[model samples]
Target: MIETIVFDVGETITRDDRYWASWADWLGAPRHSLSALVGAVVARGQDNAEALRLLRPGIDIDAEYQAREAAGRGEALDEADLYADVRPALTALRELGVRVIIAGNQTSRAGELLRDLDLPADLVVTSGEWHVAKPQPQFFERVREVARAAPSATVYVGDHPANDIFPAKAAGLRTAHIRRGPWGHLWADDPEVAAAADWRIDSLFQLASIAKG
Candidate 1:
């Protein structure tokens, strides 16, 4: 039985439209241009942040983030940013006695913002808080530790194949590949992603059934 359901924030629980749009505005670049670059970077298996660097070579992303914040524009999330199904799906899982957690490759401020939303989750955390990011075994180890369950009893759900499905499967957890965002749709039909994911779903509502199983 799946006792815990851990989620990736970007393009899973949340749509990244505003997140990337904000970056485009900050860099004074056309939003469509940056979005296209992000998709291209993902297609090449490059980090999505490479899109920003392509916009401004040698750009210090971390410093730019700090500067954006100082200038009154930083990471922002609200109820509107959430997927339409997020609330209902999470609430349903919790009602079913399934432990729901939100842990993703997000910043500490993003974590705080997620917690502030008060979603029906046992915990909300981020790579910035844990000092580790995904595609790394240590990240999933932290996930298992925080889940307080055997790896097999937990399910990791996300849209990214390399960062979400592959590593989580390697960690011995059941994996759900959600086809929602760029990476999700782009790699959804890949032979390896299909093989790695224990479940392939297009909607968060599908998780209710996975939890029950």
Candidate 2:
């Protein structure tokens, strides 16, 4: 019996493409034509500095989003706010008696986003709070500790293989990789993660079905 469902906010439960599109639009770039250089910067382990030089350019990435929100042009700039149709799935999970938790590299903005969407989560474990990123086993171990999740009773659902699947696997948790997204590494694609995943799904709606069995 799966007791807890851990979610990766960006591409797993939320629609990250729309958020990327918003960023491209804010930068005055064609949404489709904007070079996916963000991926390269992330792969190369460059801080937001390189990404700013190429994409944001003299704009404070965080401040710009806040400004947009202040000007009423943005609702919530955080992943929890920008992603779509997540609350419903979370509600469904709760209805099905699954304890839901969020694990991501987000600021405290996650709490506001969840409150805005009115989603019910037992806890949210973020990278900022943990001081570690995924693909590092310590991250998952910390989340497991907070959620008190048994290895056999919990699963991690995320879009990236390294950040989402690898660390979770190393931490002895089952993993579900969400397909179809612009995650940093093409190597994190679902087919690749599926080769090692205990389960796989294209969307959060499919999670309950996958977990029930």
Candidate 3:
């Protein structure tokens, strides 16, 4: 039985098109260009930050982001940025007495940002805090260790099959693919990605059904 459900923050539990679009605008790249670049990077089975930097070179990411946060634009996302299905699904799973975790490979402060949002997470962690990103055995190991969960008893939900699904599967956990965001929908038909997931659902509402299974 799945006793723990770990989630990827962006796209899976949150919709972030506007989030990336705003950054693209701020960085003087066309919104679609940024989006396409991200898709291209993921298509190559690579992380998207390198694509962002490639699209807009020589900009100090940390400095620019810090300055923006200092000026109150906020650090990437707020509680309002979450997808509509997130709250109800998380609430449903929690009501089933399942342990829920929010884990993301995101900006250095993403873990803190998620924790501040009053979201339904018993634990929130990030690659920034752990100094390790997904697709690495250690990252899943961290999740497994902290949740006090054996991988077999865990179900990881994410949008990116390259980074989330395959790795989690290798770590011995089941994976659920949610097709709502860039990478999710972008690689929906990808052969490897299509085969990686044990479950596929278009919305978080489906998670409730899995909670009872």
- The most accurate candidate by TM-score is 1
The TM-scores, one per candidate, come to: 0.98, 0.74, 0.89
Ranking by lDDT: 1, 3, 2
Q: Residue by residue across 1-213, what tens digits does model 1's lDDT show? A: 999999999999999989899999999999999999998999998889999999889999999999999998988889999999999999999999999999999999999999999999999999999999998999999999998888998999999998999999999999999999999999999999999999999999999998899
Q: What digit string (tens of lDDT, one per residue) describes model 3 on residues 1-213? A: 779999998888667787778788777788989888888887786877767787878868778788768877655667678988887888888999889999878766767778778787788888888899887899989888876777877999999887899899888888898887778887777788778888888998898788789
Candidate 1 or 3, higher lDDT? 1
Better of 1 and 2 by TM-score: 1
Clashes of each: 0, 0, 0
Best by lDDT: 1
> Which 10-residue window in model 1 sums to the lowest lDDT?
144-153
lDDT score of model 1?
Answer: 0.95
Task: In angstroms, give how far residue 39 of model 3 lies from its true place.
Answer: 3.2
